[model samples]
Target chain A: MTKQRAGLYTALTLLAVLFLIPMIWGVSSAFKARSDIFEYPPRLFPAEPTLENFRAILDGQPFWSWLLVSTLVALVSTAVAVFLCCLAGFGFAKYQFRFKNALFDVLISSLAVPFAVIIVPLFILLAVTGTLNVWFALIVPWVAPAFGIFMMRQYVEQSVPDELLHAARIDGAGEFRIFLSVVLPLLRPAVGALAVWNFLNSYNSFLWPLIVVSDPDQYTLPLGLQALFGAEGRQYDLVLAGSVLAAIPSLIVFFVLRKQLLDGLTAGAVK
Target chain B: MSTVSAQPSWWRRNEVRLAPYLFIGPFYVLYALFMIIPIGAGVYLSFTDWAGLGAPQWIGLENYRYLLQDNSFWTSLGNTVFYMSFTMLVVLPASLLLASALNARGLKLRDTFRIIFFVPVVISPIVVALVFGLIFDGQFGLMNALLQAVFGFGGIEWTTDPLWARVVVVVLVLWRWTGYLTIFFLAGLQNVPRELYEAAALDGAGAVRSFLSVTLPALRPVTAFIGVTVLVSTAQIFEEPFLLTQGGPGESTLSIAMFIYRAAFQRQELGYAAAAGVLMFAAVFTIGRIALRLFQVGRNA
Candidate 1:
């Protein structure tokens, strides 16, 4: 039994090390001066450890602007999605209106539709509406996440009792008032989970934003990073630095909301 | 009962009851406009020869017929399938193995490991591709540089060489996805009843034997979900290959999604591209159904 326990510990440690490789590489590579990045045997530590890559990415590119775009879009979209999905999730979970099951089925099945398949039509829609250059194009499509609604529905159904809702209603609470005061408070944990999911999904969004926004100033961090891939001139260190920049927000969110995030992901599988 | 008046009529009496729909109305309307209408449009556009701006010329069944002979489309389809299969073969086992290890008792800094593993999934694809592109760079890449130093061998041309390019793509997919799948499997592992393991051990089942007989079988549903999702998502792989290889090294790494995008946007053949997408979607759906059924049967057996 002691031997078995030792074996498991050894295995887990090795797995953990393997997982840390890329991230370690990302940060270490960022500190390497441009010239040292492609050095033979790839020294794990840079001798000079210059922040040239970071400096170049920051000063040369509109890195701050792009980061701002990403933050605004991720935050605003997450907020909108959480608000809308909570109401929808609560309605589906608590109330039995006409065609409730059918509507939800449609919503869930819509999950299979990949964004790549819809990019062109969305582009066309935005183009016709003359909202092409506007930030609305970047924000709107992500604001109504079906998965968020689905997860929120599941969480609310299992956790929030209908008796509580009825009591609140019996006390002459308006429907919206009941939702805001009663339902939203109980949904805090699920809301935290959904917030992280929506933020990451919105922040990491690629295809739609790639096609919709043509202007550099309008570019999100992901799109801006893709723009760096242009030209034959390869500044690998700078690219890695930029990638590290792109990854930090989502990584931070995952850490801070780790429990909720795990629950959100596992919710589907465990169900 | 005395206080209860006539039940509120569906429309007038319960107009306030419609608040949920009112809250949720925006999403459905947007989905209908951006998602539903486009899908319908995509299906229609597939039959017609629509370029981006100009009026679409009706070419019923012709685009599909052309796709039947389009060698590049077939090649792209084949490549995507190959990539997906390779990812499943390599990454699936790795994920399960890692999850098992992580589930082991008294692991140090396990949460830290989970976060690190999940970093790839959270990072933008463009960043992943960019870093990978540097690593796979033919001459200046760290991969080749290391190969030269350690093994006294010349670096393989990763992006420019056809076979190597495909290998790099598979490797990228593995790197990006392995952690995501591991987390799912870990979750699945957590829900597994601990008593089953104790019972298996008491029956004199070795670790390997017990895992094979018990844990693997128990994880069948999550396995099925992961398998179908991974395959479908792999089939639609775009940004990684788009950024890394740009479907180059002689079109060896061109995914069906990339093919569709190229045909539609780059070549301005929206009709043909839509047809290709529809075909790809059908292929994915059919495979997903088969995989799901097989998983169910395997579980039952």
Candidate 2:
């Protein structure tokens, strides 16, 4: 490589390190006790690294309960979203139907509308129906993600052949059976991708849960973490611990399913 | 084949095509309940006098009229614009440059670097705000410590001072979003044809020239998508400002969404809040379309 090329590479290396600093900070901060956090010279390596924050967070709040609630909600919601998206995607991809394009357009356009725009009426509707505290409040809103359907449709169109569906039907398989037996089994990759995306979104969600679920007992992880910052008092150690705890599930899921996560994001963007 | 079955007319076929509708049934029903009806309700309520738990009075265009004269509403709008521009002008380019550099073939440990850069994108924004809040702490912060180490000057009150608080919020938005944008640009860059780069080189185009002529044009769609999404999302900036400054040290970082949330949830002025939301929705959609169009024109040129 030329001198300039080498120099450019070195510069890029520095940039990457700069990008890595926050994650380093988060992990390092999580390890430090209260005194070590605000040290004057700022300790890159905490002199007395501790897991007190983790312990406190687990003990102080109903951290375990909140974690369980968030996990269940994210998993259940993603499963529903993936299943519904598969059925819809296969139908859209395979069959020619009346008003298909019109219905699809409505769903596509709905993707661009911000969640904030719908919060008001949805909140009112939830309140009126008295479903505010139930798991359904979070699950129902996510069941029919427009982007998920769009993604699955794109995947199915590209991957699932029409002949397969025809052959299955020729064997006397019903439409529902064809979907369950033929289309869905082939859609596992898209399902996996959409599932991770949905889980991350549902888990990281803040605004909707904040508005809809008033009771602390019904709080998702993000909402529960937010409460730690509220009037009861700001315990920095406890908050950091809670934030770390809240982030772990998504991190594990992200790492395990990195490729699908990328696929889901870009495909979701393009479609 | 002995016989061929005839295809039925479209609607006749579709009547049994309850299959497609059935497939898509959940989304349609949920969209109506969760999205469409709510949007219509929000629009109708914007012209009324409704609090959280009461009948909405049909109070003409008073809410809109009030919004016109409200100084805080205007201030929040200005802040939104400021934050949007700050992120676009500074963060977008920085991330793009960083992405391009990382995508360079000469770069070693590429995947590790990408993962590091993408960490913030996955982490909770609320947690990011908390970390930033600590970093920008007035009395005892890492930022102040660094400042004292180098310049020996007093630390600026990051979250307390109006101007500084806005700056901090902008920084928080940038930090949270730049990594996310980098991943998008990286994805876009991976698809750019390498032959164009080789052609540019053979034509004696310098690295900069190749980047300008060959690389940038290929990134146009990705840029357009990210630019519009960032603009729209920034216009609704909430979590960072909400956690960092609590929309303070006097509404410096208060965004339109934050304003709407406060009005509806805290003040219980649901109708006026809906007006604020509708206005926000309009502004974001308008700005996004305009940006995408401008980017397309520039790309064509």
Please give the clash total of every predicted structure, in order.
0, 1
For residues B90-205, write the lDDT of model 1, one tens digit per residue: 89999998888888766677777777777778878887777777677787777787788888886799999999998888888888888889888998898889999999999999
Superposed model 1: Cα runs more than 4 Å off: B1-26, B148-154, B202-209, B286-301
User: TM-scores for chain B, in order?
Assistant: 0.88, 0.89
Off by over 4 Å in 2: A268-271, B1-18, B286-301
Estimate the TM-score of every prediction: 0.90, 0.90
Which docking class does model 2 fall in? acceptable
Per-residue lDDT of model 2, residues A1-271, tens digit only: 8897788868767866766665667678888998777767676677888988998888778998888888999999988888998888777778888897777767655644766666776787778788776588888877878767877887888788889987987776778888898888887777878888788888888877788778888888888888887746767778887888788888898888877666556653432
Candidate 1 lDDT tens digits, A1-271: 5887787767766766756665676678789987788776677778898877888899998999989999998999889999989988887777767776667756755655655666665566567678786478888766888767777777787788889878987787778888899989998988888898889888998877777778888888888877775744756766778888778888898789977887676665554
Q: Can you list the residue pairs that collide in candidate 1?
A: none
CA lDDT, candidate 1, residue A34? 78
Model 1, residue B240: distance off in Å is 1.6
DockQ of each: 0.47, 0.46
